[model samples]
Target: MVPQLRKLTLMRKIKVDIFRKICTNWPNLTCLHVDFRQEMNYSLMKHIFEKCPRIEKLKLWTTMLIDQRCMELLSSLEHLSTLEVLLDKPHLTPVRLRLLTDACPRLKEIHIDWNYFAPQDFEYFLKANKHTLTSATLLWTVGEAQKTSVVPLLKQCSTSLRKLRLVYFDTPRAMETVAFEALGELHSLHELSMQYLSTYEPKLISRAFRPGCLTQLRRLLMQYTTDLLDETVIAISQGCPNLRELRICASYKITDVALSEIHCLRHLEILELSRCSGLSGTAMAYISQLPTLHTLILQFTEDLAKLQPSLRLIVELKELRCLDILKSGNIKAVPFGEFPNRLLKLRELRVTYESENDFTELQRKMPNLKISNTAWLTEDDFPKDDDADYGYRDG
Candidate 1:
C-alpha cells in the first residue's frame, strides 16, 4: 500500500451511531451516501462538519420538512459540489434556499424530488444565484404568478446553465394546468425537461422556436402534455435541430402530421412516443426513415398497429437497436411468418399481449436479441429506496 495513494469513499446503510464511528475512523472521507431514511438534525450535522471536513459529495433523503435550522447546518459545508436532497414535506422558501446557495458558492448541481407541490422560492433562488448554478431541477406547484414568471427567471442563468428540469412531483391524483413559454433566452442549456401531471394544458409550449432559444439543446423531454398537438411537434423539430434525444409520453392530440414534422431532425438518436392516441401508423412510417435513430419506444400505442404495412414500416428502421412495443394493441396479429431477415440490428425488444404470444418465430429472427414482456422486474432486481432498501451502491 502506498502512503499517498489512499482514497476514501463510503456508501452503506448503517445506524447513525455506526456512521458517526465510521466518520471518526476515516476523517478523510470525501464521498458519502446513505439510505433515504437517515435522520439529520443540528447535533448530527454539527458532528459531521466537525469530523468530515474534506467531504465533497453528500446525499440525504429525509421524511421531514427542511426548514431554517437544517438549512443553517447545510450552509456550513462550503466545498460541496453536488447535492441531492429528497424531502417528504414540501415548501423550501426562497430566503432559506438563497441562504444555502450563498453559503456554498461552489455548489454546481442540485436535484430535489418532493411530495405535494413546490412554491415560488425556487424561482427566486434562480434569479438571485443564477451564475453559481450549472444544473438544477425545480418542481413547483401550480400558481398563476409562479407559472408565468418561471421561464423568464431562467434567463438569469443563461450564461452557465447547461441542464434544467421543471416538472410536477405532486401526488398521484393531484393535477394542475400549466402553460410553458419563454425558452428562447436559454441558449446555453443542453438538456431541458418539462413534465406535468395535468393532461388539460391549453398548450404545452406557446412559442419555443424563435430561432435562438433551443439552438444548442441536445435533449428534450415533454411528458404529461396530453394536449400536445401537431403544431407543437413542428415547433420542437424546427426550434432544436441539435437534439439527440426526445421523449413525449401521454400525448393525446399528436397526429401523424406532428411526427412527420419531426423528419427534419437528422441527428436524433433516441425517441420515445408512448401512449399517444391520435398517431396511427403514419408516424412510424416517417420515423423509420431516420438514419441515426438507434432506440425507439412506442409502448401502448394501439393505433400504430392498425395494418400489416404499419408493422412492416417499423422493420425498415435498420439502425434501430432497441424497440419497445409492449401493450401496443394488435401489432402481434400481423403474420411475418418466421421473421428471420428483418430487424437485423435490433438487440432488445419488449412486448406484451392479452392472449397467446408466439415468441418462437420472433426469437428465430433476432437470435442475439434480448426480449421481455412490458412489466417491471422482480422486487429483488431493483429494491425500493425505503427503510428496507439500500438503493444503489457507489461505483
Candidate 2:
C-alpha cells in the first residue's frame, strides 16, 4: 500500500499471480521498469498501465510482442513521454509506431535496441515527432533500403533532436556521403555517436565536419569507421569548437595531424583513441597541447621507441587526472611509473603491468593515486539487467 512511491522497478522474474497482487499498490508511480523472461502479454501490460495511470517513463526489457490491444492500453497513459524497449525479439513495427504517435500525443524521447524498423517506418516516426522528440537511440541493422530514408528522416528532426546514437549491426557498407552530410543540419545536437559507418571516399565526409554545423556538439564518438581520415577529424575540430569529450576507435587512417587540430577545442577534457595504429608517438605531443585535457586513453603501442617519448610528453598536461594505457604491451617498457610523481593531479592510472612489487612501490610513492590493470573498457551501450535504470529523462 505504498501509494506515495512514484518509481518502481521489478527486474527479477515475478510470477503472474504475484505481480497482479501488488501491481495496484503503486498507483502514483511515474516511472516503471520491468525485466521479465516470460513474454510480456496483454494481461501484464494492462495490469501495469491501468494501475499506474501516472507513469510518464517506462522501460520494458526481455521478450515483448505487444499486439494492437496492448498498444491501445499503453497509449492510455496520457502523461507518457520517455519509452525504452530492449526486447530479445523484433517487435517495433510501423503499425505499432503509428498507433503510439496517433494516440500518445506527449511521447518524445525513445530508445529502441536490437530491433529493425523498415525504411518507411523511420520516415513516419520522424515526421510525427519532428517538433517534440529531443533524444533517440536506435541500435539496429542498416540495409540497402535504409540509405535513402536515413538522411531525410534525420533532417526532419534537425531543429529539435539534441542527442542521436545510430549503431548498425550489419556488414560494413559505404553509406552515401549525403547521409552523413545531413547530420550537420542538426543544429541543436549536443552528442552524436555513430558506429560501423564505412565509406569509400574519405574526402567527401569532411564536408559534414566543417564550421557552422554541429556548433552545439559537446561530445562525439565514432568507432570502426576505418575510412575516417585526418582531414575529416580536422574539420570536426573546426565544426565542434565547444567539444568537451572525443573518442575515436579502430580508425587507422587518422594520424597525429588530426590529433593536432583538436587543440582548437579549448574546453576539451577527455580524449580516447584506441586501435588507431596509424598514430605514431608524435600524436602524444599533439595531445599535450590541450592544456585543459584531464583524461587520456591511448591503446596502441606497436613501436616502443616512438611511444616512450609520447608517454613523456604527457608531463605537459598539468591538469591530467586519469591516464589509461590498456593493451599497449608492457607498462614497464615506458616511463609510466614516473607519471604519478610528475603530475600532481593524477589520481587514476590503468595499464597492463603485472608486477606486484612495481605496483606496491608506486602506491607507496603516491598514496593518493589508484592504479589498475584492466585490459579493456566496455563500450557505452544500453543498460542491461544488472544496471538498474536507463538514466532517461523527460524532454
Judged by lDDT, which candidate is best? 2
Per-structure clash totals for the candidates: 1, 0
lDDT for each candidate structure: 0.63, 0.71
- Candidate 1 C-alpha error for residue 358, in Å: 1.6
How do all models score by TM-score? 0.79, 0.85
The prediction achieving the highest TM-score against the true structure is: 2
User: Per-residue CA lDDT of candidate 2, range 1-395, in tens?
Assistant: 67789887776777887777666787888998776574478887888788878889988753554565765677788898988776544444433566677767888887775455666656676788888888887643433344343544677644588887765533224545556677677788898876555555667767767799888998887766778889989998888998998888788888888877887888899887878888876777788889899988776655545555675777788899988777776556566566666788988888777676778877888889888877444535222322222212100
Candidate 1 lDDT (Cα, 0 to 1): 0.63
What are the per-model C-alpha RMSD values against the true structure? 6.2, 4.7
Cα error, candidate 2, residue 366 (Å) = 1.6
Off by over 4 Å in 2: 61-63, 114-128, 139-147, 169-175, 200-202, 300-306, 375-395
Give the Cα-based TM-score of candidate 1 against the true structure.
0.79
